[model samples]
Target: MKIGLYFGTFNPIHVGHLIIANHMAENSDLEQIWMVVTPHNPLKKKNTLLDDYHRLQMVFLATESFPKIKPSDIEFKLPQPNYTVNTLAHLQEKFPQHEFALIMGEDNLNSLQKWKNYEVILQNHDIYVYPRLNSGEIDSQFINHSKIHRVGAPVIELSSTFIRESIKNNKNVVPMLPNKVWEYIDHNLFYKK
Candidate 1:
């Protein structure tokens, strides 16, 4: 089995996340896409992040109905300030029979050099990149690489920050999030002002 790891904070697991995962699952040779919910992204601020467990649960709720997509809590048990290369190493060791690939946006690819052990990640794992609006083109060095694949997933402008702000301002985020996710956020009064 080939798995694509779609790592994210998934602050609320909005529709844009789902769309990208679904597109990858259908368009790529991947057998499944695991939404690897990072406990803490070293590059991003942690003050506004929801609890890791809460974020994980919302991912599960949002992806439960999709057979090819799964929500993973793999990062929760791993060391904090998780690095992609470290998690990939752990996953490969644990699931030796399965082939694993990294799924990300073009924007992330632009900053790939900033990640820990990024060269190892590029050399060892296949990468599926979805386009992001205004993200510019991928670097020429990676454009023709066999390990790197560019996917034509729709460009969604939604962001977790935007969703949180909308909810705080009492704006309807129904269009931006999965139905169950929105219900969970509303019931739990998450992102309240």
Candidate 2:
């Protein structure tokens, strides 16, 4: 199987995430798109993040209706401050029979050089980059690379930060989240300040 790994903290899964995953699964060469819920991202702040289990459950609830998409907790079993290179290596070892591609946004592509062992990541895996609003043009070096493919997925400006803030401020977030995810957040009183 050819799988596209969409890694994120997914503080809470939102519609924008589902749209991108569905687009990749249907429009790209990937047979499956796994939403790898990172326990903690080395590059991001953790203060506002929900617990790893809650975040993972949100991903599961949001993606349950989509057969091509799956929620993964692979990073929870690995080391803290999870690095993409290490997770990719572990995944390769565990699933040698399958081909793995990394799915990321154009914003991430702009910062690829700063990631640990980015060279190895570029050399080993296929990268499917979806467009993001205001991410600017991709650098020429990556634009010409054989392993990097720019996918024409819809660029939704929605973000987990926005959703969390809306919830904290007692604003409605139903439009941004999956119904079940919104229900979960509502039931658990998550993100309430």
Instruction: Give the lDDT of residue 176 in candidate 1.
Output: 91
Tens digit of per-residue lDDT, candidate 1, span 3-44: 999999899799999999999999999999999998866567
Stretches > 4 Å off in candidate 2:
41-46
lDDT of 2 by residue, 1-193 (tens): 9999999989888999999999999999999999999786556766788988999999999999999999999989998777899999999999999889999999999999899999999999999999988887777889889999999999888989999899999998999999999999999999997
Q: Model 2 lDDT vs. the true structure? A: 0.92
Q: Deviation in angstroms for 8 in model 1? A: 0.5
Cα lDDT, model 2, residue 75: 87
What lDDT does each candidate get? 0.91, 0.92
Backbone clashes, each candidate: 0, 0
**TM-score per candidate, chains pooled:** 0.95, 0.95
